[model samples]
Target: MKPLFVTGSSPALRLTVALLLSLTLIFVDSRYRHLDFVRSTLSVAFYPIHYLAALPPRLARAVDGRLASEADLRERNSLLERENLELKSLMQTHQALQAENRRLRDLLGSSFKLRDRVMVAELLEVDLDPYRQQVLVDKGASSGIFVGQPVLDANAVMGQVIRTSPLTATVLLITDAAHSLPVQVNRNGLRTVASGSGLINRLTLLHLAKNADVRVGDLLVTSGLGGVFPPGYPVARITEVRDDPGSHFASVIAQPTARLDRSHEVLLVWTLPALSRAGELDERPLDAAPPAGMDTSR
Candidate 1:
C-alpha cells in the first residue's frame, strides 16, 4: 500500500477544504451568474426526469376535468329528456280538452233545437261483448234516468237505456242483434220495422212488400209507434234495396245516422205528452215508463 499511494494531509483538514470550496462556488454562482451556462446544461440533461416527476399531478387534473365534463353532459341530457316528456304530455292533454270542447258545443247546439227536457250524461264504460252493443252512462236512477229512456247523441238517436243502478245505467245500442225500432220513410211516410243486423252500420227492414216504395238514399226516422223512441228523430238511411221476383218481400239495408260507436256523451230525453185529435192531452202513456222496481223519486 505504501508503494502504491502516498498521504500528505489529515482527514479533518481535507473535509474543511471541501466545505470551503463548495461555499465559494455557491456564492459566485448566486452573485455573478457565471455558472449559468453550466446550470442550464444540467437542467436540459435532467428535463425528462423533471417532467416525469410532475406527470402524476398533471394527469390527475386532466382526468378530473374530463370526468367533470362527462357528468355535466349527462345531467343536461337528462334534464332535456324530462322537459320533452312533460311537453308531450301537456300537448296531449290540450288536444283532448279541445276535442271535448267541440263535442260539448255540438251537443249544446242540438239541445237548443229540441222541445223536450234533456240531460247530458257522459259514458262511463263500453261493453266489450261484440254480440251485445251496449254502453254505461254516468247517470242512473239517482239522476232520474230510467229504463227505456231514449239516448241520443248530438247527431241522432244512439240507443235506449235498458238497465239502471243507483249511480249508473246501461244503454242498449240500436246495432245490437236483439234490438229493433219502428221507423218511417221521411219522403212518403212508408212505415216499416228497422231491425238490427248485428252490424254497427247496417239495419234490416223487416217484412217489406216487393212493390214497397222504398229506395236508396231515403231518410228513415222514428215513427213514434214504439213507446221507447220519440217521433221524427233520425234513425237510419236506406242504402240498398233488392227485390227478387220469386220472393214476396224485398231485401232492404240501411245505415244508422247516429254515431253509435263513437259517442262519448249522450242525451237523456223526457219527451212531452202527445195531444189527441181534440187537442187534449191523451191519458194513454205515450212514453215507456221506468221499470216497476226502479226508484225514480229523484
Candidate 2:
C-alpha cells in the first residue's frame, strides 16, 4: 500500500519538492558544518556497497599482474641467452690472447730479433693431398702476402706461401716432400737439409752421414744458409735415428715444430736476407775430412 502511494504521487510535485529540499540543504551546508557530518554519515553507510562495486575491477587487475609477471620472465630468459652467447665470444677471445702472449714469450726467450713484419690470418681450409700437405689462408696479396713468405704458428714454422690472390692464398706446409729447409741441429750446429716426407707430422734430415752428430731429441733450427727463412727459427725435432749397416747413410726422421693438424691462426712473415756485396757467393773455408765410418757418397 505504501509503495502504491509513492508511485501514485504526481511526478512534477515530487521533483519540485526534491529540488527545494536540495537548495535548503546546500544553503545550510555553505553557512554551517552540519552537512559535513551528514556526508560522513552517508559514506559510512555506503562503504559496504562501494567495496562490492570495486571487487570485479580488483580481480581483473590481479589477473593482469600475473600475466605481466610471466611476460617479464620470458623477456628475462631471452636476455640471458643473448648474454650467454656474448660471454662465449669473449671467452674465445681471451683464449686467443693467451695463446698469442705465450708465442711471443717463446720468441723473445730464444733471443730472436724478428725484423719481419707479420700479418695475422686464419687457416680457411686444409688439403691432405697425400702428395702434398697444404692449407689455404684467408689473407691474400692485398694483405701484403706473397709467394715464398714464411708462415708460422705459435710453436714453429708451418709453411711458405706458394700462391696468392687478393682475398686468398695457398700455403705449402713443411711436411710436403717438395718442401725443404736449410736447418742446423741445435745440439752440434751440424747443418743439413730438412725435407718433408709427405706424411703428416713427419720430416726427413737429408744428406746426413751415418756418423752424423744428429740424434733423436735434437732440435733443428733454420740455418739461414739458403737465405729463404730467417735464421734460428724452430723447424723440426729429430724423432728417429736409423744407422743401418747395409745402408750408406743414416735414415733419420723428425717432426715439425708447428701444430700442423690443429693450427687455426698463422702469421705471415716478411723478411728478406741481407744481401752481401760478394755477389751471392761468399768464400768460406771448407771443413776437414769426414769421420772414418762415414760414407762420402751420401
Candidate 3:
C-alpha cells in the first residue's frame, strides 16, 4: 500500500543529479580559477588555529639553531685563545735568543781588542765585606792563572789575580784599599799611582804634583811601569781633582772603566814574550834538497 506522498524523485535520478553537479564544480575551478577568493576567505578565518598548531615545532627549531651557533662560536674562541698563547710563548723565546746572540757578539768583539793571549772565565762569587772589593773567578792555577796576573772585563781592567787554587782564583779589584797600580794620563802623559779607596766606584791618584796636568775628565791608562798590567790598557777616568795648600800633592778621584759589580765574564790576560820573527818564519827553504828516499820534484 504505497502512499501518494512517496511521489519524490526516483533514486537513480537523484544520484545522477549529484554526480553531474560535482563534475561541473571540478571543471569550473581548474579552468576558470573562480574559487581563489573563496579559498583565501576560508584561510583567513582559520589562520589563528593553524598557526597555534605549528608554534611548538617552529619555536623548538629556532632554539636549537641558536644553541648550536653559540656552541660553535665558543669553540672558535677557545681555539683562537690557544693560538694566541702559543704565539706569545714563541715571541718570548725569540726575544731571549736574540739577546743571547747580542751578548755573545759583544764578547767576541771585545776579545779582539785585547793585546795578550786571553782565557775567558766566568765570575763565581763577590766579596760581601764592605771593607774589601774582591771577586772570585773560575780559572785557577790549573789554567795557568797566577797571582799578579791582570784580570779584565769586556770594557776595561777590573783587577789582578791575588790568590789562586787548583780550580779557582781570587781577584783583588782596583777599588780595594790595599790595591795600587801605575797609571798615566792618556791626555798629557802624566804618570801617577792610583790607589783604591775601598769603594767600588772611587780611586785616588797618590803623589800627584800640585800643578799636574791632570783634569777632572782625563782618562787614565796602565803605564806598564809596574809590569803587572799591559801598557796602554784603560784603567780609570778622572772624576774629581782638588788642590790644597797644606798638602804637598793634589788629590784626584777616579772611577774604574770596567763594570766591576755587574760583569758576568772576565778575561785573564797573559803577555808572553813573542818568539823572534826569524824563528817564527819558515827558515827551511822550499828548494832545499830532499833526502835519498824522497823525491825533490813531484
Candidate 4:
C-alpha cells in the first residue's frame, strides 16, 4: 500500500531524519549505556591490520639497534686489546728498571774499595762474533778514553778498551781468546793469569800447578799488576780444578762474575797511577816485572 506523500517533506527532510536517529544512539551511549564491549571487539578485529601496518618500522628499528650494539662491542674490544698491550709494555719497562737499579746499587757498593776513578758509559752496540767477543761503547778518544783502558760492569771485569775513535770505543771482552788478565785467588792470595777461552762464561787459569792452592768456589779478583784493572775488583769464581799429570799445566776453569750479555751500562775506569812530573817511577809496564824489593806497585 502506498503511503500519502506530504507536500513539504523533500529529500533533505529525509536525510535529516536519518541523522537524528544516529544522534539519538550517541546520546543514549553517552548518558547511561556503556559501549566498551563494542570498542574492544572492534579493536580486537583490527589488531592484525594495525600490527601489519607498524611491522616495517619496528623491524627497521630493531636492525638499527642491533647494529649499534655490535659496533659498540667491537670498539670496546679494540680498546681493551690496546690497553692490555700497553699494560704489558709498562710491566716490562718496570722490570727493566728494577734490574737496572739493582746493578747500580752493586756498583756503588764496590766503588768504595776501588782506587780507580770510574766514569759511566752506555753500550752502543754488542758484537759477539764466532771468533771474537767484543762490544762497542759510547765513549772514545774525546772522552779521555785510550787503548788498554779497563771496562767493568756492576759485578766484575767486562773487558778492556782496545780501540778508540772520536766518539766510540771497541771493547775486547775478557772472554775473547786473545784477552788475558792477572788474577788471584781470594782465599790464599795465589796470583795467576786467567786467559780467555773464547767462551763468555769460562776463563782458563793458565799454568796452574798440580798442588795449586786454588779450588772450586774460590773467588778470583784482580791482582792490580797490569796497571789496567784495579785490585779487589772481582773477576771470576773457580768452578773446576783438574790435576792431570799427563798435561804439564793443571786444568782449571773459572766462571766470570759479570753479566756480559745482559748489561747495558759499563764503567770506564782509570786505574793507572798519575805519573810524576819527572816520570821517574811510573807503574810497571805490561811486560815488565816490579822491582825485587818490598814491591811498592800501585
Candidate 5:
C-alpha cells in the first residue's frame, strides 16, 4: 500500500545507520556542551562571509600609507628654496665692501692734507655724456697721467685730465659745458669764474659784478688763478644769488664740491713741476704755475 516512494535504507543498513549517527554526535559534542547552541548559531551565520574575506588587504594598506606621505613633503620643499638665494647674495657683497672702505678713508685724508704729489686714480669710465661731463681714469700715460692734470675727489675739484692713454685717462668733469674754474670767495677773496652748467651738480658764477660780494653760503676756493686747479682746492658751494637790476651780471649758483656723479676714486694732482715731467705737462699752457710747496695763501 505505501509503494508510492518507499525505496529506503539497504546498503548495509545505510552504512550501519551513518556510523551510528556519527558516534552519537561525537559523544554529545565531546561530553555535554550541547553543541554550544549549534556552534554559536553557525558563527552568527557566517559573519558576512568572514568580513568579505578581509576587505582587499585592508584597502591595500591604506593606499600605501598615503603615497608615502606625499613623497616626504616634496623633498623638504626643495631644500628651503636653495638656502634663500644664498643669503641674498651675501648681503649685497657686504654692502659693497663698506662703501669701498669709506672711499679709501676719504682718500687717505686727502693725501694727508696735501702739498701736492698725490696719486690714487681708479674711476675707469663714465662719460655717458649728459653734455659730456667725462671720467675714465685708471691712470694713463703710464700713470703720470697729464693733459692739464688736476682731477681730485675725496671732495673737491673733480676733473681735468682731458685725455691720455698709456692705460687710460679722460676726466674733464667739473660739470662740463666745456668747464671753467678759478673760483675764490672762501668768504671774501671774491674773485670768480666757476662756469660749467652742463650740470652734474651745477656751477656757473662767471663775471659776478652786480655788487658781487656773492653770498649764499659762499666757499668756492681753488682760485690759485687757474693753474689748472690747486689754490686752496674746494670749488663751489654758493648755491644761488640772483640779482637782476636789468642784468649787469650776478646769477651765481655753485654747488659742486665735487663728487660729480659720485666719484669712485681720483686725485692725480702732482700739481705742477710740469706734473713730474709727464712729457713736459703736454706742452704746458693751462694758465700754468702753482705747485712747488703750494699754499697759494687763500
Candidate 6:
C-alpha cells in the first residue's frame, strides 16, 4: 500500500546502516571486555575445517623429508660400494704380482746345486726368539718338507728347515746363535766359517786370520763345504773388518744379502733325504745317516 510522504532507501544509505551496526558491536566488546567465550565457541565450531585446511601442507612436507632421506641413503650406499670394488681390484693386483715373483724365484733356484727338486713356498710369519732367529712357512711334511732342508729367497740363502709338522714348518735363520755356515770371500775365495750374532741381519766371520785378504765391502758366498747349504749362493757382505794387533782375532761383521724382513715369499730346496721316504721307508733309524753316502760332491 502507498502512503503519503513515504521514502525508499538508497545503496549509500544501506552501507551506512551496516557500518553503524559494526561500530555498535565494537563499542559493546570494548565496554564489556568479555569476548573469550564467544571466540572459543567459534574455534570449536570450525576446528574440523581448520584441520582439513592444513592436511595438504603437512602431507607435502612429509613427502619432501622422506624423499631427501632416501636420496641421501642411496648416495652413501653407492659410495661405499665403489670403494669396496676398488679395494677388491687392488687386492687382486697384489696377488698376481706375488705369484709372478714366486715363479721367477723357482726358475732361478735350479741354478743352485741341490739334489732334490725345489718347491716354492710363502713366508707366513717370523718367530719371536731373541736368541735364535727363526721363521715359519706354509710348507710342511704334507708338502714334502723335512728338517735340514735349505731355504732360500730370490737374492740369497735365507735359512734351513729345523722342524716341521703337518701343515707348518720352522726355519732356522742364518743369524741364530746356533747357525754357522762355510762361506768364502767372493773377491779372493778366502774360506771362513760365517757364524750368527743372534741378530737376523748380522753375521760374524770366525777364524779370519790377521793377514786374511778379506776387507770391507767384500761379498761372501757359500763355500759349499758344510754339505748343509748350496754352493755359490750369496751369504753376506763384509761391512766391517777390525784387525787389532793386541787381539789375535780380527773382529769382522757382515750383513746378509737376502731381504729377510722384506720378502713375502721363499723357496724350500727339497734336499732333505728323510722327506723322500714318506711312508715306505722307516725314517727312525736312517734319519741320522740316510743320506750320508749320498753324492753331495758338488
Q: Give TM-scores for every candidate, taking all chains together and pairing residue i with residue i.
A: 0.54, 0.54, 0.53, 0.55, 0.25, 0.53
Once superposed on the true structure, which residue ranges of model 5 sit more than 4 Å away at CA? 1-128, 135-141, 146-158, 161-166, 177-189, 192-195, 199-203, 206-210, 213-222, 225-228, 231-242, 245-249, 252-269, 272-298
Residue-wise C-alpha lDDT for candidate 3, range 2-37, written one tens digit per residue: 896768899899999999998987888655546645
Model 6: how far residue 125 lies from native, Å: 2.5
List runs of model 2 lying over 4 Å from the truth.
1-114, 126-130, 272-298
Error of 1 at 233 (Å): 0.4
- The collision pairs in model 4 are none
lDDT score at residue 69, model 4, on the 0-100 scale: 75
Across 1-298, the per-residue lDDT of candidate 4 in tens digits comes to 6659766779898899999987986987555425534543554565455446546755776787677876798998999999999989999998898778778978886422224588998875334356788886767677988767778998899988766665667788897776778899999899988878778898888777888788899999998766666678899999999988788668899999999877878999876443221122222224122234312111
- Candidate 1, which segments miss by more than 4 Å at Cα? 1-114, 275-298
Q: Between prediction 3 and prediction 5, which has the larger TM-score?
A: 3
lDDT of 4 at 149: 75
Error of 5 at 235 (Å): 12
Query: Model 1 over residues 1-298: C-alpha lDDT tens digits?
Result: 3667657888899999999998998999745646745654664565456446546755776787677876798998999999999989999998898778778978786422235789999875334467777886767677888667789998888888766665667788787766778889999999987877678998888778888999999999998776667789999999999986775679899999998887768999887653122123122222323233321111
How well is each residue in 258-297 modelled by candidate 6, as lDDT tens digits? 9877776898875434233433332221211213332121
Residue-level error in angstroms, candidate 6, position 105: 26
Residue lDDT tens for model 5, 114-207? 2478899776433345567786655677766767778788878787876565556667777776567677888788787676777688777777
